[model samples]
Target: MKYRSRTDIFASILQSANSNKGVGITTIMYKSFLSHYQLKKYLSIMLENDLIKLEEDEHLYRITEKGLRFLQLFSNINELIDTTKEYNV
Candidate 1:
């Protein structure tokens, strides 16, 4: 399998969490194909950066508006890169 960059991983995590109403840490890890340690580290950073919010009552995580915006921007950037590569620019 091709290696994924941190931005790609973050985008995957955010996309997974956004799709689910109340997503658990393990669920995100499994869906994102990340190990426990890696999930924990990324989750912490996402929470701290306001990309994802944790629900204390249910212990579930949800993506925020900012996170959605980040995903959109990331997708656009990736598309731009691909387009450039296609033209050998």
Candidate 2:
């Protein structure tokens, strides 16, 4: 597994948090395969950046508008890459 920094962590968090169903740390941790130490550090940074908001219950996280916008762009790039790869193969 690759070691990810705060920026990398935020990208995943932003993406996962976009859904209205909300997301949990465990899911993010699993999806990103982040270590406990890295998860805490980056989660705090994501909150500071306003990319995600913690639920009052402290069990769920939601994406902010800023995060959604970033995710939308990221998703577009990912789709484009997939399309290109498909054509190449």
Candidate 3:
């Protein structure tokens, strides 16, 4: 995937995680087109910032409320751009 797709991948993953459903890092890595090292680095930062939580039992991850709020803000920004594009203004 192109590098820009990384943003969309993150938004999708965070939306999924917002459901409080756990997700696997492998899946995220694959979908985001990120290498293990890159994913690990970003994951570490997100974890440290309390944006995501890990489930020890299943080795899964979920987004925290802060993450969800951030994702929502991103979505709103995307919507604005999409709407502007439609207007061709």
lDDT (10s digit) by residue, model 1, range 1-89: 56888888999999989955779988898899999999999999998999999998999999999999999999899877764344533
- Give all TM-scores, in the order shown: 0.86, 0.70, 0.72
Which residues of candidate 3, in runs, are more than 4 Å off? 5-13, 16-19, 83-89
lDDT of 2 by residue, 1-89 (tens): 55655555677767667778788888888877777787778888778988888997768988898888877777787677654343533
Candidate 1 weakest ten by summed lDDT: 80-89
The predicted structure with the larger lDDT, 1 or 3, is 1
Report lDDT (CA) for all predictions: 0.89, 0.76, 0.74
lDDT of 3 at 50: 80
Q: Arrange candidates by lDDT, descending.
A: 1, 2, 3
- Inter-residue clash pairs, candidate 1: none
lDDT of predicted model 2: 0.76
Candidate rank order under TM-score: 1, 3, 2
